[model samples]
Target: MAELESPRVMSKLISFLSSLLQRVAESNDLNRRLQPQKISVFHGLTRPTISIENYLDRILKYANCSPSCFIVSYIYLDRFTQRQPALPINSFNVHRLLITSVMVAAKFMDDMYYNNAYYAKVGGISTAEMNFLEVDFLFGLGFHLNVTPTTFHTYCSYLQREMLMQPPTINSAESSLCMGKSSKLHLCFNDDESSHQQQQQQQLAV
Candidate 1:
């Protein structure tokens, strides 16, 4: 249990700080490469055709959730959609698929706990339907739920150390308490999925 929780609860918090700063410094330097020449079947996923962005943005705006979160949630939807090209498409069907994907991601990423009932209540569905969707999504992803990465973990770790390193006159402990509340708020921001195969390949290659 100690080994399991050690890295989960505490990772020398110092080491995580440097790695995070590095990622931040490098984030802007990274470029995307979906060569225009290549034919991606889902290239239809691009905006000029479906305008998925505007469609999702409208729904998420109603929910008071960021368009970015819905966008990332669609990334998860595509993880399954890309593999199976024939999934049915409908108004509420799209929302159910996308929302269920995000809930799975929230469960993995949020420091706070989430349950299917919470999704059902907000989604105005029975808990049984949420459960079925959850199961369907898992099976679709080959029983994978550990795929999403939480950017909050690094941000929280950095905030903790930043508060710690401040001059003593600032009341370091008090500063930490104040920052803790703010960090909790940012954790609500849905983070982007980094690499899908990285987690799977790393484990399997070992």
Candidate 2:
């Protein structure tokens, strides 16, 4: 847990989230430009009006969950999207999904996490809505809450590599080169699935 709170870990988490927000922004911009006719029919039409950075800042300041919980929340987000193909992460639902994932991760990973009501208040949502979202997200994830050490490290490494590959600014001429380097990092995880599964099985047997 202490390791989770370390500066390195926190930086990696922030970088990972920043990348996701960047993607969301790009996707929204592309939709606005290339699909103007279909924009009104987009699922993100009902998405929250809040900025992703501001929303994440609110959670960082008020959620009071372990820093590790944020990392776990990222993992849950990945698993949730994989399991529920219908609910892809995007601007329309990402904010709500972030709050639900972090709340659920905190509850599962922290022994002293706040209750659903408190989480609702922190997330600026009704308690009942929070409860409903929690239930829905749990089912969406199929209750696979356990993350092995190997998997955790793999994610951390991936985020760190991405951070290193991100150009300092959007207009940098080297941005494309940096993105190419980042794409290569996916190979690091290509062989991780079998090892991660084996680690999970060993832990379960213990």
Candidate 3:
């Protein structure tokens, strides 16, 4: 009985983690797909994907960023998505938006932001490169950076709830996973992009 239960328990945990990561990737892809695609950056492609998760992933990896950064980035994307009346933006344009959103998010959310980010060091090509990407992203979303999920009413409710709960990891990861996806939030648009990236690589141009 113990042996059987162990496999079942592990199976459930793996499923939960996979589901969480899927939620994150979905959010990320949604934001990317909403970009305007009528640009050169999206053409000349095969085995195409919705966004440059790799480019965004690279920039994020090179930066001394935080979870707050992901929050802010997702917020920015949500805001942009909400305001934009258009869709099907190319991957390049979306990538630019995400990078700029991260920069803008850092400025808005943190006291001191990282300046003088060298492209070589940060995995971006250059400041000009950054600007170019930001502009395109901004253009696609129509510069809608005002609205976001972080400020949503339900999010506020969850924060209040999270504060009341015992601190995270006090319970097993499975316990945390079982609580719920809506409030627990194992994934979101900007977060969890790295999870299951291997499957993503197989399916995408990356």
Best by lDDT: 2
Off by over 4 Å in 3: 1-37, 40-60, 87-94, 119-123, 135-206
Error of 1 at 82 (Å): 1.2
Worst 10 residues of 1 by lDDT: 197-206
TM-score of each model, in listed order: 0.39, 0.70, 0.43
Clashing pairs in 1: none
**How many residue pairs in model 2 have overlapping backbones?**
0
lDDT to native, each model: 0.40, 0.61, 0.42
Which residue pairs collide, candidate 2?
none
Residues 1-206, model 3: lDDT tens digits: 12212434323322332333334434434555444323333223342253354555565555445435544465555545444434322233444454666765554455545653443235344666665555655675565444344343343344334444533331221211123445343222332222211111111111
Cα error, candidate 3, residue 116 (Å): 5.9
lDDT of 3 at 59: 54
- Candidate 2 lDDT for residue 180: 29
Off by over 4 Å in 2: 1-4, 7-12, 25-45, 167-206
For candidate 2, lDDT tens digit of each residue in 1-206? Answer: 34566767675556567566556445544454443322211134465777766777788877777787787787787776556544445566677778898888777666566677777777777878888888888888787777777777767665566666762233211111122235521112222333222111111110
Ten consecutive residues with minimal summed lDDT in candidate 2? 197-206
User: Candidate 2 at 90: error in angstroms?
Assistant: 1.5
